[model samples]
Target: MDFYLAAVLQGLCFSGLALGIYLSMKIFNIPDITTDGSYTLGGTVTGIMLAAHIPQGFILPAVLLSGGVAGGITGFIHTKLRINALLAGILVMTALYSVNLTLMGRSNLPLLAFANLFGNWALTGSQGPDSLIVLLVITAALVFLLGYVLRTDFGIAMRATGNSESMVRALGVNTDRMKITGLAMANALTATSGYLVVQLQGFADINMGIGIVITGLGSVVIGETIIRRFRVVQPVSVLAILLAGAVLFQLALAVTLTLGIDPTLLKLVTALFVLLIVSLPRIFQSRTA
Candidate 1:
């Protein structure tokens, strides 16, 4: 039970990443690989700040800024330099690796001695329940705020920029700025995931972001599958579905681990699971046909 609980907490932590991926891939139709880097950038910033005895509340803006900058760089490269979005993202992600290392001054930094976001919550004399509640609140607030944003005029423009860039451009929407802003916001959320995870795990490592994009992608894929299955068309409900998908994805992995799968094979299992989610509908349709 505790193992599964931990998995649930992890899913909550990654919810931000799932939201980020949803924005970039689903909203903007850009496969921004910057997720792999900006995530660790969040952790790196948090680790350094906490280590310096900074207030946890004061660290969030820094994390968001770092992540946003990383993403913005990718967007700039893609839009201004006329590079492929994927390649531009890859370039920024690769650069962020060194940036994270340089900022941390090492490959790994232990955060066990620092104050975390949950330090103020002393309920039940155990961190689990408190952390759970806090995460739930945080996740809910994020979804609500994001939903509201998506309904605003600027948000509609952002969506339009993604859905029909040429059309939005013709309408004088400055599609280029929209793309940059969208990527920046997406990576800011991704970085926040890193911020939460590093504090939860009590450590930050340069390699922590490696393959992290797959986790977010898997969650989005699962959410997308559910949305399609239920024919859920409401925008806010779609966000809720994606958040639920993050938790469900983690639970699936926990069950796999409980079944005695080798821990080292977790990544492979994740990949296969995502592939299955992505291919299942096509397979069913073919069979029915």
Candidate 2:
């Protein structure tokens, strides 16, 4: 039971990341590689701050802002300098790798001895609700916030820009600003997830974000596959799909683990899962046609 609960908690953490990726990839039509670096940046920043006696209450917001800044930089380069979005993301991600190292002062940071965001509650013998409760709460808040934001006027403009930049520009909307805002918000959520993850795990590893983009993209694809047939889609439904995909992905991992699969091969599994999910629609369309 504990193992299952832990897996679900971990899934919720990854769900936040998946939501971020979905915003960039699906909503904004942007292929962002900066997520890989931003995830680590969030963890590095949170872990270092906590280790340095910073108040745990501020760590999450700090990490979230750092992520937004990192993503905004990439957006600026892409929009202002007219750089390709893909190349811009790669450049920002490359720079963030060094920045993350500087933030941690090393390749990793240990938070085992530090006061974590949930440490006080845990110390007070609040065993009824573990860190999992915190994870769920954070995830729910993000979902509600994002859902609300996406329904606003600016959000509609952002969505329109994603569908047709030229059309949005003709409508007197600043497409560049929309792009930057969307990217910044997406990466902020990604970083926030990383921050919460490290707090739960009590450690932050620099290499923890390896293949993170792939994993996030896979989760989005999986979610879309599950929810593609919905007749009436809502933001809540989309959020639920994202979380469900994360849980399903973790279930796959659990199955592999039970089968004695090596942990290192998980990346390959994620890639394959993405490939299958992405191709399913085309396959079905062809069959029906």
Candidate 3:
């Protein structure tokens, strides 16, 4: 039970990552691989700030700004230079690795000695349940904020840019600016996940973000499956479903671990699981056809 509970907590921590991916892939129609770099950049920023005894308030903004800048660079490359979106993300992600290393001054930064975001809370006297409450609130707030954004006129324009770029461009909208801003916002959220996770895990490792985008993609895929199956249309409800999907994905991994699968095979399991989810609908469609 505790193990599964921890999984739920981890899922919540990754909610921001999942949301970022949703915005980039589903909303902006970009496969922004910059997630792999920006996530670690977030953790790196958090670790540095926390280790220096910096206030949490300042740390959060710094993390968001760093991630946003990284994403914006990718967006600019894609839009202005006419580079492929995927390749632009790759270039920025590659550059962020060296940046993160230089900023951290080391490959790993231990943060267990400091008072973390969750370490100070004693609501339940058990960090796991207490942390769960904090994460739930944070996740809910994020969902609400994003839901509201998606409903605004600006958000409609952003969505239009994704759904019908040519039409929106014809309507005198700056589609390039929209893409840049959208990617920036998405990566800022992704960085927030890094901030949350670094504190939760008590350390920040340079390689922590490696393949992290896949986890986000898997969560999005699961949520998308649920959305399609139920035909969910409400923006707020859709965001909530994605959050739940993140939790479910973590639970699935927990079950796998409990079954005694070698820890070394975890990534492989994740890949296979995501593949299965992605392929299922097509399989059913084929059979019906």
Candidate 4:
């Protein structure tokens, strides 16, 4: 039971990454691979800062900024250099590997002895309750903020840009700016998730981000699959779905652990889950048609 609760809490921390993935893939129609790097960038910055005794408030914003910068660079490459979006994202993600290593001054940074965001709660024997409270607060704030943003005029322009860049450009909307803004925002959220995860896990590893992009996409797909009927409520529905997916992902991990499954096989499970979710709609549509 304790393991189950822990996994759920951890999943909530990762919900931010799932949201970021949804924004890039669903909203912008961009297959952004930058998230794999940005997630580690966030964790690297946050872990380093915490180890250096920086205040928690400062660390959080810095982690977000690091992600935003990495994403913006990728966007710039795609828009200004005429690079294919996938290649541009790959270039940025590759560069971030070195950048993250530089930030950590090593392949991994451990926060086992450092002060974390939930230190007070942990010291008071309230870690579980406090973590749950914090997760809910952050999740609610993100959902509301994203909902508001997606309803704004600029948001409409962004959605239009995604649907048809040429049409949006003809309408005087700067499609390049929209792409950059979307990517930056998406990666900022991704990094924030990384920051939260390291705080909860007590360590940031250089390899921690491996397969994160797929995992994020998996979460998005799983969420969308379950809530496909809500066309008007897509954003909110996707958010709920992502949160639920994260919980389910964690629950699966817990089950694997209980079954004595090899921990390393977890990534394979995630990939299989993603494959299943991705195929479900097509399979169903074909059968029904």
Off by over 4 Å in 3: none
- Candidate 4 stretches with Cα past 4 Å from truth are 122-124, 230-234
Better of 3 and 4 by lDDT: 3
Candidate 4, residues 46-124: lDDT per residue as tens digits? 8989989998879988988989998898889998899998999999999999988988889988899998977756533
Give the TM-scores of the predictions, in the order they appear: 0.98, 0.94, 0.99, 0.94
lDDT values of the candidates? 0.94, 0.85, 0.95, 0.85
Model 2 per-residue lDDT tens digits across residues 204-249: 9888888888878877877887787664378877887888888777
Q: Which lDDT tens digits does candidate 3 get at residues 35-136?
A: 999999999999999999998889999999999999999999999999999999999999999999999999999999998899878999898889999999
* Best by the lDDT measure: 3
Better of 1 and 2 by TM-score: 1
- The better-scoring model by TM-score among 1 and 4 is 1
Which window of ten consecutive residues has the lowest lDDT sum in model 3?
Answer: 119-128
What are the per-model C-alpha RMSD values against the true structure? 1.0, 1.8, 0.7, 1.8
Ranking by lDDT: 3, 1, 4, 2
Candidate 1 has its poorest 10 consecutive residues by lDDT at: 118-127
| Candidate 1 pairs with clashing backbones | none
Count of backbone clashes, every candidate in sequence: 0, 0, 0, 0
Better of 2 and 4 by lDDT: 4
